[model samples]
Structure formats: C-alpha cells, structure tokens
Target: MQAWSMTDVGKKRRENQDSTYVKLDHERNMALLMVCDGMGGVNGGAEASRIACEEFARSVWDTLSGKISGKEAVALLEKGVSAANMEVYTSAISDPSYMGMGTTLTAALIVGEDAYVINVGDSRAYHLKRRAKDKLKQITDDHSVAGDLFRKGSITKEQYDTFPDKNIITRAVGTDPQVYGDVFELKLDKGEVLMLCSDGLTNMVPDMAIEQVLKTSETPADACQTLVDMANRAGGKDNISIVVFIKD
Candidate 1:
C-alpha cells in the first residue's frame, strides 16, 4: 500500500485554501484519502477547509479498526462527513468573518479490494484500473452550475470550459445547517489507482492529459508531483490539491 498527497497555491491565487488527509494502514491494506476546496474570503476559506478536512479524517480514524463489511464502511464515511459539516457550520456561525464560509469535500476509503467514496460539492474522486487502456473514470458528480449544464447536455465541453459561472458551486459543506454527501462503492483490484482532488487540477488540466500522466507515472508520488506541475504549466489559477493511492 502506498499513498501521496500534495497541495499548492497556484500561480493566480494569493492563498491556498485547499486541504488534504491520507492515512494508510499497511497491515490491513486500508487507506483513507480526503481533499477539501474552500470558498470564501482568505481567512474564512482556509479555515473552512482545514476544519472540514481535520474533522472528517479524525472521526474516521477514531472508529476504524481491522476488517469491516462494505455497509459498515459506508456508514462510517457518512458519519465522518456529517461530523465535518457540523463542525464547519458551527465555526462559521460563531465567527462573523467566517459567516458564509464553505468547502467542497471528496473522500475515499480503500479497504482490501474495495473502495468506498463520499463527496460533497465539486471536489472529485477518480479510478483507474492498471490493466485498462485509456479508461479514467470520474466517480463523483460536480454540484456546480457549469457541471450541471454539461451533464445535462445543455452545454458543450468548450462552453463549459469557458462558462463564466463555472466556478460557482451550487452545493458545499458548512454552507448550511445540513449537507448530504453522495456515496459510491467500487472494487480496487491490485495495481489499480484511486484519486481525490480539488478543482484546481481539473479546471487547469484536461481529463485526457491527467489520464496520460496516471498511466505513465511510476509511483503515486511521481503522479502527484507531475500532475501539480502540469496544472501550474497550464496556468494554475486556483489552489490545487490531490491525494493518490495505489494498491500494490
């Protein structure tokens, strides 16, 4: 089991409001990966992401033990997200500066041969099977205006790329009293890869290019650095963060 995570304040952003967490249980071949992208003013955004990422990771770690069933894993992931949302929402209400702070969260838990995922807002989860060719599957849906338009076939890929409101997300954690996460369960055979990332990478790097790097990179660390570098080269415009793990 191997995992790597990286975060960068992109060329155009004054601060990096992205946060990530990775916990690997080598003995059990289990790993937990999470990424959060915050939206708000400088302080609010950063704080929101930090709180959400930490709370979720901590909650899961507290209860995670040896082997478990798929159903139990999904319930634990849901509980973690709920705990994170409540903490962020509470902090937002308590502080005037963070009144409207919120963040997008994408989390994946890899246990044995299966991966359980949960997502809120625009951050995403992706899967790539080592034996498959050119098949990089996106596992989460974006809760943003442009994302909705593109999914509904109301807009072309070109239009979505240039959409003025592309950055405006419709759903987020900590923005309201309650937030629901989308959950998914998938298999992760040996040598397969699972990734969680903020929008900075997706917005700047095309999916095909991302798939190419994942296919060619030798290790999770290499893939992470290469992707971040590529995003910067493509005119990094936001905070970029990625978490990648491979079942070796």
Candidate 2:
C-alpha cells in the first residue's frame, strides 16, 4: 500500500480549516485515510477539524484494537464516527466561542482486499480503476441541499451548476447531539485508486479533469500536488485537503 496527502489554506482563507491523516497497519494490512473540512469561526473551524480528524482516527484504531472482519470494520467505523461527533458536539456546547463549531469528515479503511468508506457532511471519497475507463467513481454523497436535489433528479445538471445551497450541508459533525455517517464497502483490486477530499478540490475542478490527473500522475504524491495546484489555480476560495491511496 502507498499514499500521499496535502492540505492548503487557499487564496482567500487566512488560516486553513482542513485536516487529514493517513496510517498503515502492517500486521493486519489495514490502511486508513481521512479528510475533514471545518465550520464556525477561525479558531472554532480549525479546532473542530483537528478534533474530528484525531478523535475519529484514534477511535477507529481502538475499535479495531483487535482482529475484525470487513463487516465488523464497517461497524467499527460507524461507532467511531458517532463517538467523534459526540466529542465535537460536547466540546462546542462547553465553550462559548465554539458555539456552532462543526466539520465534514470522510474516511476510508482498506483491509486486505476489502475497502470501506464512511462520510458525513460534504467531504467525499472516490474510487478509480483502469478497468473502469479512467472515470472517477464518487463513493460518498454530500449531505447538502444541492446534493439532495442532484440525487433526487429534481435539478438538471445545468441547473445544479447555478443552484444555491451547494455549500449548505444538511448534516455535519459536532453540530448536533448525534450524527450518523454513511458506510460503503468495495472490493479492492491491486491497482485500484482511492481519494478522500474536501469540497475545495471538487468545487474548483471537474471530475473529468480530476480523473485525468489520477490517470496520468507518475506517483500518488505527484497527483496530490497537482490537485492542490489545480484548486489553487481556480481561485482557491476555500481550504483544500486531499488524501490519495492505492492498493498495492
């Protein structure tokens, strides 16, 4: 297994509210990748994203503290996500400055030949494979109004481009007492590629363009830099974060 990740503050943001993590379990052959985009004021947004990334990854590691199956891995991720939400929510309510602090979290766990994805809010996960014609297969759905409209077929592609609420996420970590994350499982082939990213990359670059980068990059790190650069070139309106991994 191999991976690369990057986070940027973007052109307009004074500070970055994005965070990411990547770790590999050599013994169990489990790889974890995550990205978080925070909300609230400056300190709150940064802190929220930091807590979610650290807590969620640690909780997941603890849940699989022992041996687990693919199904159990998925359940563990769900439990970890809920725990992370509670942690953030409790922290937000405890402090005055962090009143409405929250964040979007997207994670992927690859064990052996199976991969599991979990997401909340607007951050996303994707799967790419050469056998799939070099298309970026989006694995997570954004928990936002635009996402809902796009999914329900209520909005046309052209309409979605101009639709508002694209950034108004319906669900988020730390915004409520509880938040449920969506989990998906897939079979990972040797050359399959996975990406976990914040809205920064998607909002700036189209999927087709992203797919081209994934296909042409010589290394995962190169792709990571390329994506960040692309987003920065496209006006860099928000904090950017990306994690790219490949099954080897």
Candidate 3:
C-alpha cells in the first residue's frame, strides 16, 4: 500500500485549520491515514487539530508496536480516538484561550487486502471501486447535519444547494469528553483507492468531480492537488486537507 497527502489554506481562509497524518508499517503490512478539521475561534482551531492528529498517531504507533491481532488493531484505533478526545477536551477546559475547541476526524487503516475506516464528525473516508464501463463508485456517507437532512427528505436539492451552515457537523472529537465514532471494514482489491478529506474539499466539489480527477491523475499527489485546486476555484471557504491511498 502507498499513500499521499496534501493540505492548503484555500482561497478564503487565512489559516489552515486542518491536519493530517499518513503512516505505513511496511513490515506488518499496515497503513494508516488520518484527516482532522478543527473548530474554534482564532488559533484554537489549528491547535485542536494538531493535538488530535499528533495524539492519535502516537497512540496508534505505540499500541500497534506491541503483539496484537488484527482485531486488536481496530480496537486500538478506537482507543486512540478516545484518548485524543479526552486530551483535547481537558486542554480546552484548562486554557481559557482554547475554550470550546473541537475537531472532526476520519481515518483509514489498511491491513493486507482489508481496510478499516473510523470516523468522527463530518470528515469523510471514501472508497472508490472500479465498476463496469471504467467507472468508479463512492462507498462512504457524509456525517453532517445537512447530510442527515438530505437523507430524511427534510431538505430539498435546491435548499441544500443554498443552505447556510452546510458545513456544520453534528458530531466531533474534543467537543465532549466521550465521543463515539463509526467503524467499518471492507475488502480492498487491485486499483481501489481510498480518500480521506476534510469538509472543505467536499463542500466545494461533488463526488463525481473527485472521481474524475482521481481517474485522470498520474499519482495520488497529483490527484490531491487537483482536488485542492478545484475547491479553491469553486470558492474555498475553509482549510482543505486530503489524503489519497492506493492499494497495490
């Protein structure tokens, strides 16, 4: 497995509030990709995101280094997320400057031909599988309030298009002491691609556009840049971060 990642402040945002990490345990055939989008006032957002990513990476690395089964790896990922949440929550409470700081997290771990996905808040993990006619299909759901409203038929297509606060997420890490995340396991095949990104990219570009760019790009790095460029062209309203992974 191979991974590439990129981050941009975007056209409108003055600072990047997003952070990402990609780690590959080649000897164990394990690969991990994590994306975090922070929320707060001023620098608080960036700090929250940085802390979450760093803590998660450290916890995962330490836990996976010990003797454990594949299932244990999944559990460790969840534990790492919980630890990160507590760490951020405590920091926010202790420091007046970082009050109410929070962040959305989404991660993917690849072991052999299987992929494990963990998500908190609106950050997304997408699996693109090739289909007939050389097409690709997306295999993840957005976790935003807008997404829920769209699914429940409460919001029409026109309303969704113009809806304010469309990026508002219903769940996030560090918002509360206890955070629950969605976990998924899937089988990976040759030519399949996994994308983990902040809402900034998704808010500006649709799934089809993402598929088109990834399909045409020569490498994951190019695909990531194309996506960022497209988002900035479409009016980048927030910090953008994305990681693209290809399974060999």
* lDDT winner: 1
User: Which regions of candidate 1 are displaced past 4 Å?
Assistant: none
Residue pairs in candidate 3 whose N, alpha carbon or C atoms collide under 3 angstroms: none
Q: Which window of ten consecutive residues has the lowest lDDT sum in model 3?
A: 130-139
Candidate 3 local lDDT, residue 65: 60
Residue 78 lDDT, candidate 3, scale 0-100: 93
lDDT of the structure predicted as candidate 3:
0.84
Lowest summed lDDT across 10 adjacent residues in model 1 is found at 128-137
Tens-digit per-residue lDDT, 1-248, candidate 3 = 77899999999888899999998877787788999999997888998999999998888865666445669867977988998899889999999999999999888878778888888888888877644345555455666788789879999967875679787788888988899788888888887888999988988998778888877777889999999999999999888899999887
| Residues 54-160 of candidate 2: C-alpha lDDT, one tens digit per residue | 99988997567656787788888898788889989999999999999999999988888888999999899988995646678999988999989999999987777
Q: Which one wins by lDDT: 2 or 3?
A: 2
The residue-by-residue lDDT of candidate 1 on 1-248, one tens digit each, is 88999999999999999999999888888889999999886599999999999999988876886899999999999899899999999999999989999999999988899899999999999999866454899999998999999999999989988899888998898999888899999998788889899999999998888888888889999999999999999999998999989888
Tell me the whole-model lDDT of each prediction, alpha carbons only. Answer: 0.91, 0.89, 0.84
Position 202, candidate 2: lDDT: 91
lDDT of 3 at 11: 90
Worst-scoring 10-residue span by lDDT in model 2: 61-70
| Ordered list by lDDT, greatest first | 1, 2, 3
- Clash pairs detected, candidate 2: none
- Give TM-scores for every candidate, taking all chains together and pairing residue i with residue i: 0.97, 0.96, 0.93
TM-score of predicted structure 1 = 0.97
